[model samples]
Target: MNASRRDLLKLGTLAAAGSFLPAAALANAGSGVIEKAAKPLRILILGGTGFTGPFQVNYALARGHKVTLFNRGKRPSPEWPGEVEQLHGDRNTGDLKSLEGREWDVCIDNPTSLPFWVRDAGKVLAGKVGHYLFISTISVYADGSKPGMTEDAKLAEYKGKDAMAETMETLRADIENLYGALKALSEAEAHKQFGDQVTIVRPGYIVGPRDETDRFTYWPKRIAQGGEVLVPGDGLDPVQIIDGRDLGEWMIRLAEKGTRGTFNAVGPDYELTMDSMLHGCHAVTGGKVTFTHFPVADIPEDVGLPIWVPREGTPFSGYGAVSNAKAIAEGLTFRPLATTVTELLTWYRALPAERQAEVRAGIPLDKEAELLKAFHAKQGA
Candidate 1:
């Protein structure tokens, strides 16, 4: 089936499962809150066609908020229900001329990778927009720490060049490490431009349907094969992730509520360990699985290791445990972890066989089992 038909079929299937929401239900829960205002809030999202962007767009549209997207017009979205105003421009060239004189209630910055880009965008929208929401990463926290870390923790300081060439070189070398520092610097720039109006949402690994990146996709595919699972650590290492839909909802809620400050937008603080996370996936997929843990040192030098290994001496240090109390207190609640896993599995199964196989490559069940066994054995020895 073609992409369009496939999307329709997926939507139909999800709708039957009660996972999909009608546009009306997506509207504000009640008029007493931010929704009660006479005028529908206008929102501008930079990079609304990418993986996480579409979810935000769908959410805002469902809530009856008017949305305008600013992008280079290179990556067009498939058909969407509501009419979204598109502003064509490239952040690289700093050409946001199309957005001049247009003010919005909120602006979600999704595409900026560099501090300069954020700085320029903020300069343009500073006084024009009410709330400037920066979709930041959990990576901004110092490395290796997990659970209980709050948003005010020490941020990674990035002094590297913000231009394309320098940024690309650093990114190509180590994406995970570089991403946090870069994001921290970018957030700092945004704060400098728009202090109280800026809200930073630092989300942990976000996973859901239509995710182009295969980081979270590996687990579901692995479990579907029904075999021993390869676990990075003792399966005790903390893990946290937020569904894209939930993230989108909370972001919109934050805007509507006029919440400020740095919020760690993640899943529940409890039940955030590697074992529980994988077990959740296993239960949803109904796959027979056992975990084999590897010590940090014995991770084989291979092309396709699923786990992230930190450099020696840097072992899980900064922002290890993040606290979401602030967001929770501000009306951020996640669906059960089991629900997220189940939906993720459903989405995975809905993909065409060809696409499924492409992502499933380099993740054979036996190899995973073998690696897990080696790692576990080393730990025992």
Candidate 2:
């Protein structure tokens, strides 16, 4: 059955209640509500104009916190409600002078892709910020993790100081392991500088509105076109995504509650499978999508798939599923997958017609049709 936005909102509300309620009341109310604490927080967010930064900005604003943004002032955005201060600086050359004398309750580091950059920033803002939150990725784990790996499992080690030099190019050519290692090193540096004041949020694929890159948008856009859809691999591989807004909310909550430690900020620990993810997209778009599941052996040698592709012998082996119990226990909850997909589609539709064409041109229609046919055939089988 197709899931509606209303249904997804209801699910999110219920999940929030269950996730935020106290343990004693959880049994009777099935709600997750923690005691409210009042300490108006002032936050500074690095990389506030990026894909995930805006959501974080919105979330903090909603919670009645003051926010200061540090960026290069390249991409200007709509003015935010409430008090928002923007500082101009570049982290590459260590020109964070604008933030020299400032102090905030918490600082969310969203753009520290390199260890040196993180180390420099941490050195500058160490004692000034109360809590330093570094947004890391799930890629920090070993290449092939056990089914559901927790935070303390096999972590990637830093190769060297110049490890993140070729991040952009390497990330595209399937060298995310190095990227993760550098980020892991960066997180370690932040903790080293601030100790117990650091909170590391390692998230899976993050999807939501105002997404400049259409990585996750491709699925919803293709499904909304209403035809056969492509199924990579068995269509049973587990897929997890944390909505940008949910990640933002949880980050603010952590700052408010002074939560610490490395938490896996993912979705509900429920029966989520690859097929269910695709199905959720189909339901949200109200499109009839037939999946054509391609066997590992039958995948065309030259067919370039941009997303996850597992190595041989391990169907779910390449990217291991992350456990969110730690984050949930610390008051992390997810906005339903259905809601995320719908909002993603809505944002895509709101784009200019020319921009939409530009995005769709990335994928060849014939290849998409073939994949959809394969996915549908697999569904029937």
Candidate 3:
């Protein structure tokens, strides 16, 4: 099963209403660190109201870069720190009339899942922008069972009849089979249009504030509740993730330096295991949380546990171990694990009470309890 299949189910769900991080936390998010460019660059972001785009906008403004956002004007946008030009267009229907004759120093394609989105934008953006940056996923790898895979790893191929003709409706009809392959094709299409000026960033499990998916947020919130925690696997499975803020900020820096190449935008600059991740998040909470280990087999096939994948007999077993050495060598950095956990919980706590009651990802408490009981009984027998 695809690791991100669960997340796609929550697609089109807008950011939770009343989602706001504490002002102090926002101030501290990128404190003591600044990557200002030598000269201001005109930066254009395709989709700037989503999880990571706001971070990019804020950081770019702080670094004295002029920023512009192009997206369907359906969602609410945050208050930008500096002036930002907003243009509206629908890429799904191939309506990119708004971008004609516009030029920018760099273009960041944040939400291109369909190859046609790239094809349509390329018609308007080719040679208009100095650089093209496409945000792709780590799922593009054809064989994810191998540990330490790099950007050169074989990518999944589009098995569809016509990749350029595939639409959002068609993609949703078979997202599990097409999402990765389509993204891989989109990367190729971007290269075909922009050549050496294209930058492909492949990231896994982007978790932090303003993320409504709650894939990684489930852990911090569950641990904060102060009770028995049912942990899948022996807690030895390697895990890789990048805070969205780190990713967004780094992309701006990449645009500033004109860094061009494919890089795995994963985190920590070191090896991180599920054991370390859980305990690291737990450290930020004052609640008493005791964890009980359970076999990966105990997890029901229908149940999707966020961010924990067993190494034995599992597809994408090496998903958590993909190499980020190339990205690190190019100035990729990570915030403290505690910071990610704290800010996520802080942002989550600010959500409406009704929204707080909804757990977007991870096992339900009752189901988790039942599984834990079953695991204990088998051990006793």
Q: How displaced is residue 123 in candidate 1, in Å?
A: 3.3
Q: After superposition, how far is residue 229 of candidate 2 from its true place, in Å?
A: 1.4
lDDT at 175 for candidate 2? 46
- Each prediction's whole-model lDDT (CA): 0.64, 0.65, 0.82
User: Each prediction's TM-score against the native?
Assistant: 0.80, 0.81, 0.94
lDDT of 1 by residue, 217-257 (tens): 67766766776666665566555566766777788778877
The order of the candidates by TM-score, greatest first, is 3, 2, 1
Which residue segments of model 3 deviate by more than 4 Å? Answer: 1-30, 33-35
Residue pair clashes in candidate 3: none
> Using lDDT as the measure, what is the rank order of every candidate, best first?
3, 2, 1
Q: Candidate 2: which stretches are off by over 4 Å? A: 1-37, 160-177, 301-320, 360-363, 370-381
Task: List, residue by residue over 1-381, the lDDT tens digit for candidate 2.
Answer: 111112111111111110111112111122234343376789999877665666667666656788899988877554554567999988877788998988898999886656777877877898999999988876677544455678887777765446536444553353434566676788888888888899999876666665545656777787788766656677666666667667776788898988889988767567566678778878888856677665655556555443333433542254426678888889887767777777666666766677777652124677666655665577789
State candidate 1's TM-score: 0.80
Against the correct fold, how does model 2 do in TM-score?
A: 0.81
